[model samples]
Target: MSSKYSLPLVLSFTIHIVLAGILLLGDFSSPPKPTPTSVQMEPIQAVIVEKSKVEAQINKIKKQKADDAKKLKDLEQSIAAAKAKRLNEAKRVKELERQRKKKAREKKAADIASKKAKAKANAADKIRKQKEREKKQADEAAAADAKAKRIKEENDAKKAAKKAEDLRKKKAAELKRKEQEARERAAQQKLLEQQMAEDMANRQQARRQQMMTEIGRFTALITQTIKRNLITDRSTMEGKSCKLTISLAPSGFVTNVVTGQGNRIVCEAAKTAVYKAGTLPVSKDPEIFREMRTISLTVAPDKFN
Candidate 1:
């Protein structure tokens, strides 16, 4: 029998035994007080007791005790089976709880794993996007650099062309300026030469005029002196003239005299008078003196006193 039912079964069996003992011992308990005997004179009769009937009654009591014992044994067996069934049910319930806990733990672990996988996938996607962004930026930067380089090159080319053109223009202007300067120099040189020639001609002309004036004045003095010394006979020399050439030194000393194309008497008189004067008026200036050194004169004896 299961221990759970053993105590109750034993207690029930013990209570039945105690009830049986009470019943058996109830006759031996102190006898109740004796009732008063009745005094009646009645004739007594002899009765035969049957031994088979009494034996039959004793056997019936023994059979009833055995039936009760059988019922108690059956009750103990039923209680033990019920207790065993309860223990089995409890074990079944405990096993079901264990399985439920295990399933819960596995489900929780699965959820955690799924979440971790999703997180890893998200992280990878994020990294990929970051890389794409960086690559796109790099491409944009490269394109910008190329464009800038092209623009710079174009600007440099334009600047170079402009510089060359400017240089050409500057050189052309410089050459033109030099040519103009040369022309101006030539014109100035020609002008200077012309001015110098004009100045020289003017100075020469003035010097000649002054020399002629001096020569004329000195020539008149010589003629007057020759006339004063003339020993002419006016009656024979009237309306007759002679031309005489006289030579003089720088100091007015007479050097020589010759007569030309005139009456011989008049010419002789004039030449003799010129010699008699001993000296003639001459110029002190070298140029005027050169002209006066040999001078020609015309003399006529008319109304001489």
Candidate 2:
């Protein structure tokens, strides 16, 4: 079957065929001739030699078979090792695929969460802006109301001031009119009194003129008597003419004497002569006495002078 056993079997069969042919061809005669003496070749001894050679060949074939068996076992071991290595590579590829899928799932979830958070923040900011806008509008409205109230108050104050000023002016004008009317009444009363007094004075003046002529004659008589009574060293009584006024009671007695236009010496002499007479010759009428209490006269030593 194997090349090692088949090669050894072919060589042994060919050697036996040749040894038999030589025996059959006359090889025994040649040996017998050399042994004309009868030499006995043992059949048992040939069988023993053939058996020994076959045993030796069998031993060699067994050794070769053992060596071949060992080589076959080694080749089987190498094939099993290569199959195990391929199985390990396939498992490693599967694990790497699983890891990649897991990582992709985690990244997708994170992106979704981030989008939601951003949206929530945007909504909060929008609400804040709306509230601010409302507050600003309310403040503006309040400010406008306050400003209007202030303007109204100022207008009312101006109207009140104008009303007060007008009332004051009207009161002042009324007081002035009353004062003017009072002064006019007083002036009219005074004018009426002055007119009545002037009428009474005119009647009294007519009687006083007649009584003054009579008193002048009596004064002349008294002067003549004093001139006769007196004696002087001087020859001429040269002096200025004197006029005098006299105030008297109704009884014609002198109350006081006043010189009008004369020297002091002549007036004193005239006054003394009137005193010696003791009473002036005046008007008998009471009305004439009231109007003629004062009189004026002139005196000189010589009549012409």
* Best-performing candidate as measured by lDDT: 1
Residue 244 error, candidate 2, Å: 14
Residues 1-305, candidate 1: write the lDDT tens digits: 38766777687678678657754654344344436689756444311233444456566666666666677678668777876798899899999999999999999999999989897998999999999999999999999999999999999999999999999999999999999999999999999999999999899899899888888888878878988999888678989999999888888888899999988999999899988999887877888888788899898878344
**Model 2: per-residue lDDT, tens digit, 84-155?**
676677789888899889889988987998899788988989998999999999999999999999999999
* TM-score winner: 1
Question: Which segments of model 2 are wrong by more than 4 Å?
Answer: 1-128, 182-186, 189-305
* lDDT (Cα, 0-100) at 125 in candidate 1: 95
Q: Each model's TM-score?
A: 0.45, 0.30
Per candidate, the number of residue pairs that clash is 0, 0
lDDT of 2: 0.66
Report the Cα lDDT for residue 202, model 1.
92
